[model samples]
Target: MVQKTFGIYTTTDTTAEEERLYVELGQRHIALWTAEETTRQILAFELFEHEMSPLDSLAEVLKQVKLFSRLLDNRYAKTQVIWENQECLLVPNSFHDREIAPNYLDLMFGNSVNTLVQEQQRPAEQMTAVFRIPRNWKDAAQQYFPGAAFEHKYLQLYYRFSNDPKGIYTLFYRSHFILILVKGFKVQLLQTFDYQTPEDALYHILNTCNQYKMDYDTTPVHVEGLIDLNSPMYEELKKYLRDVSTAEPSGEWQIGSEFAQHPPHYFLPFFKMMS
Candidate 1:
């Protein structure tokens, strides 16, 4: 059974015509958000958690959730779906070839016979993100949201952080976290690592810095998602790194009042996608 762990439905009326929907799908959770089209204010949001057996597919899990069904019933002006997984590669536009996009993942994560491969180009960054989604999951999303656009989560983060000053950016999930190293308007490293403890997370961050010759004493580290300022992970980071802080929201949208209950950084990436 799918459980809604966190949610905020500011308005009961779901028939608004000027609303846009954004969804993010991960292995253990699914999150949906609705925003007003004209004002770009977040209206409603929900996060659902589910445990899948080895044989269970994402499509089947989505069909079993009631909130998903109700949300899908609403008509929206636009819908954007973000897929979150570790099977993604960022290739420079100068060296990218669509004909061999699948080969990139194949070499990195091995071949998967039951996945749909797709690519998103970032013209400004001169890079392309090649990724794969489960075939059944893609079909299920298309069946319900016929015109919804799809993209990988890393691509969205790349658009937001690729040009920032030299820093280490990290976004945490339940069992895994994404680490990005950016310097001089370019991404030096982007990869996901699984962790079982705060020590594990710190090891990867420090190790990455060491491998890339980044100074832990001077370089800044910014973190968001699923981490709290008081959490052990945050403390672990601050103990060794000179400047560590939680990332703040973009401040571009009018966030609903209910969102104040949670830390601003918790949903930083989701809000950034609306921009």
Candidate 2:
């Protein structure tokens, strides 16, 4: 089957119903993201082009604007045109200049800044992931929770492992543990720890989780690391966390999604808030 993709970026919650509207209009699966609650930031839209060209998908998107507008009015209790092509979509740039500086751009444009000044400015766009869940999971989601929402972020970690030539070497000798918070379809935090023992490493992990304001009451804690899965250090971490069940590889860091560049930018606002 051929899948068509389109992205909707809006200042308010107007684009929230675009996905269902498109699906009703004979459009295949579409991935959507919103920035409604983020303080100064407005919105970001990502459209994936798979089994079709970008131009055809773009046309299909243009054709569905009125239906999307009506859906937004009936569902989210708002009436507005939520889709704009040139405003939300970003043009490729080969310039090595300051346009690539995220921190500076975010300072000027993120949710913290006054939205009224640039209410006309559209949020930037990028290509992002669209998941195909297992059939059982999909059936459960549709049956019990039809109108539910799920949000996720992506992060990258860099670790260095030390090896020894001795017969009995140490497992926790030289590895830097990192935790990243992915938000707005980008990495927001990158925390690193240099601990001496497995206990210390585990402590750092727990402390980092404590510092992060996750939905712990309902959402599960997730950890990803580059360690020998069968090593003693891994066993100690499992024991320290009270069970080996919670200590597992992160699904986000699977084979296909490996980082292709040096590293990602840091989200300063989240850190200041964390501090």
Candidate 2 clashes between residue pairs 3 or more apart in a chain or in different chains? 39-111, 40-110, 40-111, 40-112, 41-110, 41-111, 153-182, 154-182
Which tens-of-lDDT digit does each residue in 16-86 have in candidate 2? 43322211111122323223332423243333322322224333443344244322233331112221111
| Worst 10 contiguous positions by lDDT, candidate 1 | 64-73
Backbone clash tally (model 1): 0
TM-score of each: 0.93, 0.26
Off by over 4 Å in 2: 1-174, 182-188, 213-225, 242-275
| Best of the candidates, lDDT | 1
Instruction: In model 2, state the lDDT of residue 256.
Output: 15
